[model samples]
Target: MPTPALAIVPLSRDDLPVDTVELARFMIGKYLVHDTPDGRTSGRVVETEAYPPGDAASHAFKGRRPHNGSMYLARGHAYVRLTYGLSYMLNMSAEAVDVGAGILFRAIEPLEGLPLMEARRPGVGLRDLARGPGRLTMALGIGQSFDGRDLCAGQGLWIGAIETAPMPVGVTTRIGLSRETDRPLRFFMPDSAFVSGPRKLLESF
Candidate 1:
């Protein structure tokens, strides 16, 4: 049997914070929904990393190019990218128009369409389905085509929220970055088993 659908209310652009780091923190407990031909796969955002303007770890640090132009769009837009020449990572543009900054969605707790997520990632456990940035995108059927798409539209792929308030968010330094590694820019729900990364970070919670 399919899991019962949760009440996910669409969030508008006004709901998005203009500050990069604030947006990263704000995304926790929000829902990421993808409506595809296969089915609707949705999850609660569990982890995120902020790549603010001028952050060396950001792709836009050197300034926008053809590939990263999506990061320059106004807030609430998708900035999907293929990292390490392998998997795709999903990000939300976090600044005003023409400014390059974004929040990388690291993980999500599988909520709706469990069967669809399982099919996309065969043999993976439920908690591991979207435990990482790349895995999260794959599980939701997100790809490069989703880049620059407006998330505030509340159609297709969008960010939403439920009535329940979010738990306290924990802070930690971002993972797997050579530069700006000491910055405490990563945020996650401390109690959520769906959040990915080292166990030491969880100790902070």
Candidate 2:
């Protein structure tokens, strides 16, 4: 007998299955890869927030619009959106088609193409590079053009296998929301240096 190698594969529709919170936890250790004109840039997912339909903080709660239409698509598509008319935020569609659910990528531990990421977002401190949703998208150069791209199928963007085991995730209430804020829909690696949000005793990143 021999030790088996880890299997690396793109996420399947079955992996997402219309459960926003489950999908949020599922992405904690996954990797996000983006291939741009500069090259391939990737990172290990660290923090995530789930948005199910009817939640006051969810973009889809009001129904699909031009900006958030990707949330209604099949699994593995990017739900890139402009937040507060400033930088973009990257999320991945999860659950069933037309179910209106998604997982917002709040932060990632940069594992590849550091220079490229830095060039996209200059002068940011190391720990602050991808420490927030807007910062994460900026660091990865994921913009409006990436909207609706099939992360598991299309070119230029997709998730990769986790390079490390990330277990015992910490759950917290979703951040910066005005309503439906009591739900513990946010999950993050216990102590990943790339995780973003308020200072907590358990995790700092």
Candidate 3:
């Protein structure tokens, strides 16, 4: 049997110039490939959240700091960090360096390397494998060690080509916890079982 072809593409900072909303939408269904020195794995993005500067909910809204300094370094950089000292969430710095904007990778559907993902998160159902920001990060082997790494040229990480199945768009308030509760900045593939949390309407907030 012929091997399945993977639509691989190396995304650079220049290709990510769109604003947070566009970036969030554009990333849907795209594969996030991580080529670690140890092995390789990938997942299709299903949900995302955008945050721009001056948005009270954004971590980098005020200014670059030692913790969020990566978001201000340059576009196409990984801004990964551990939340609640347990889960690791991944974000890509958007626009220019020090601009204080980013796209949070909220959920992913396991595409390639299911064994790897299952091994990373055993006993979890396939649908819930990478269905949350932190869980997906862990499934892809992302952690604070990947912080500040350039996704465009990182040895073990890069986003793959866009997928063909374009799922419908869904909007809602950001998930978990953030200072900007008033802004409905979260975007995801509506009706997709891969979405991380409970689906709520804007009025539910």
Candidate 4:
């Protein structure tokens, strides 16, 4: 069975830093684990959106700006940013340095540290715990301090695999953006109740 991943086995640099489209789809069913002072929180990746190099919808499209410079680092690193000045958005840096490829983690099915998460987002339901990028970061206690942190390192945060069968991936175009809207880069696990956004037609994986 693919129980919640406990240990931190972050994705390798060589394995990652792949194209944004490929990594976005490939990350489905993988686990993102974070250890905080509250406790260890984890979840199965349920949704993601990809932003390739030169993508106008991407922060890295401008190339190594002060805010998005983390995206230019080695693969398997966190590129956390403060969004809307109210929430933190967590993105995984993929592709080689300077290529500016990244995958946004849109949602996750919470696996561990429910109490800690609940305490963080009080009055939130279980299924909606990490249903969006900002919410996921808040739920996992991830913040801007994590920018450029190595996910493969056995630090407070990491990404790892499950022990059982993988879930099917659903792919479609990226959402809520004006630029590169038709680029077919979003990926999600269809069966996950925690997924967000409109239910558009998806290509099966």
Q: What TM-scores do the predictions have?
A: 0.95, 0.88, 0.88, 0.92
Q: Which digits, one per residue and each the tens of the lDDT, describe model 1 over residues 1-205?
A: 3433788999999988899999999999999998876678999999999999999999999998999999999999999999989999999999999999999999999989989999999999999999999999999999999998999998899999987854788889999999998899999888889989864453243
Q: Which 10 consecutive residues of model 1 have the lowest summed lDDT? A: 196-205
Number of the top TM-score candidate: 1
The reply for model 1, stretches above 4 Å from the true place, is 1-4, 201-205
* lDDT per residue as tens, model 4, 1-205: 2343365366666755367778888888888888765568899899999887888899987778888888998777889989779989889887877779789999999988888899989999999999999999999988888998998785589888756676678888877898888888889888889998975756885
Per-residue lDDT for 28-138 in model 2, tens only? 888887767667777888899998767778889888788788999987789998888998999988867887878899999886778888987889877888899999888
lDDT of 4: 0.84
Candidate 2 at 58: error in angstroms? Answer: 0.5
Model 2 misplaced stretches (Cα beyond 4 Å):
1-8, 163-166, 199-205
Model 3, residue pairs in steric clash: 35-156, 57-180, 72-98
Give me the displacement of residue 65 in model 1, in angstroms.
Answer: 0.4
Clashes of each: 0, 2, 3, 1
How far residue 92's Cα lies from its native spot in candidate 2, in Å, is 1.2
User: Best lDDT goes to which candidate?
Assistant: 1
